[model samples]
Target: MSGFLEGARCSECMDWGEKRNTIASIAAGILFFTGWWIIIDAAVIYPNMEEFNHSYHACGVIATIAFLMINAVSNGQVRGDSYSEGCLGQTGARIWLFIGFMLAFGSLIASMWILFGGYVAKEKPIVYPGIAVFFQNAFIFFGGLVFKFGRTEDLWQ
Candidate 1:
């Protein structure tokens, strides 16, 4: 416990410690959106796709978010090395994951809102395509900016 590494308990790791862990975190982020798009395109849109043009943009948004989550988590720790990264090690990862949540649950909630709004508003379907794309892309673009800059942070180094 006299040396720096000694005082540095696994709990002390600010995410993945800018080591091998970041790589794993990055992988998870990539997989997340990969799964996201597959689910969205195959499961959701594939079944109820009335708006491909809109859905396509939405898919891009999902992909962008997925990219950010992977990097964000990577900022904290590697996939298998999460234990050392500390509680907030996954902060970047989780933030990205939240964006992914927006991509997924956001749509569901919007649908519900639209359904309710349909009764009140003149629109019947209430499902808007642009909205989904807007959120997804916005998240991705912003997330990407952070990831791009944060890549050189000391936490990961």
Candidate 2:
């Protein structure tokens, strides 16, 4: 028995959970910055091009606000726990989270709409602006997900 149980688990042993969180967080940060770089590149690459629409940038703003809101609420509140019940309550917190997701997804959908309806429909079919907006929203969404769920085994967890 002594030989079999010679040693117990050690504090120096690798913590897989922490490792996963660190990797996911770093990847999410890279994606976030890459997306921003795409947006900036589009604006700078063809500065003299008058075909680019100025209003497309608004989608980024909307997504940013949603990102902020999503991060503002505590995870406990989102899960509808007792602690979160004190401030906004379970229902309120859920509602707030819902609104945040809607805004985030809406930004994504809006980018597509602008691409198809505004550009494609008009037969101009510009690639830079449309793709930039879509990538921005997508990366933000992915980054938010990674930030929010990286610590957990799964999203719902």
Candidate 3:
């Protein structure tokens, strides 16, 4: 009896540990939203939160790819079976799901920060964090697109 759908588990590859993907994805999600908040924080959200520093959106691109790949790995697992390209679709689905979640949660966090205690990092801009965040999102975006568009494996094949 099948229990429940867990996560993406590719066959052939004995070592089945998408932990890195998970970490990367989570990091991407956090940055994507946080970065956005920072970029737009200065809007009406706060009387005085708008300030443009250096551009680090390039990093966002990387994070996006990471986020998408994370979804692909976790959602397109094929344990005790062959690798199927269909799994790619599963990964894409997972990515979208995360997107929905991020939209909802991101908004909530930004709103809370705007209303209650304004989030930090606004006072000063850090090049490192911005760069890191940009890359995380960038990776997720590319990874997901590739997975969705290119499904070479059957996951369990």
Candidate 4:
């Protein structure tokens, strides 16, 4: 945190940080959209999906909300600059970011639950729709984390 945030080092970091950040953002977007594509493909391909687990969709919804929350908070706010540097001037932003992470993790767990409990337990078809939902949430969770931490100076090293 010392040298990483220093002015001299930061100038060098800034030279490449923006490019790394953009690449990370693009990766996240690709993963997120790929997940949605899988889900949508399932819905369109298997129009007659019987006994569909509604909770699978719920996982995606929760992950989507978490993603939005994670993106809503500024990076400075997440680093507690709100309290120390009076940037955001409040601690609530940190709390919101924590809640967002929790939601993202919960969505992942819920997706696994659906995969095992609803699909695996019942011995569902080979191409189960639940798999798509699980993949969607998992991708979103990983992608969001990557996007969140990708800009950090430590990661560049």
- Using lDDT as the measure, which candidate wins? 4
Least accurate 10 contiguous residues by lDDT in model 1: 111-120
RMSD vs true structure, all candidates: 12.3, 4.7, 13.7, 6.8
- Per-residue CA lDDT of model 3 for 1-157, tens digit only, reads 1332222233323333334344444555554566456544433233332332323333343344444444444333433232454544655555656664464344334333433232244544423333333334443444444343333343423
| Model 2 lDDT tens row, 1-157 | 6654544333223455447767887877887777778888887775644566777888888887887777677777677654436566877878888999899889889988877776678787466677777888789878777766665534345
Candidate 3 to truth, TM: 0.27
| Backbone clash count, each prediction separately | 11, 0, 49, 0
> Candidate 1 — which residues are off by over 4 angstroms?
1-6, 9-16, 20-39, 42-124, 153-157
Per-residue lDDT of 109 in model 1: 46
Lowest-scoring 10 consecutive residues by lDDT in candidate 3?
1-10
lDDT of 1: 0.47
Q: Candidate 4, which segments miss by more than 4 Å at Cα?
A: 1-16, 49-51, 82-88, 152-157
lDDT of 4 at 135: 90
Tens digit per residue, CA lDDT, model 1, 56-150: 54445445545545444543354335447655555655665667556544444443343344322644353444344434444444445444444
lDDT of 1 at 35: 40
Index of the highest-TM-score prediction: 2
lDDT of 3: 0.41
TM-score of each predicted structure versus truth: 0.34, 0.77, 0.27, 0.77
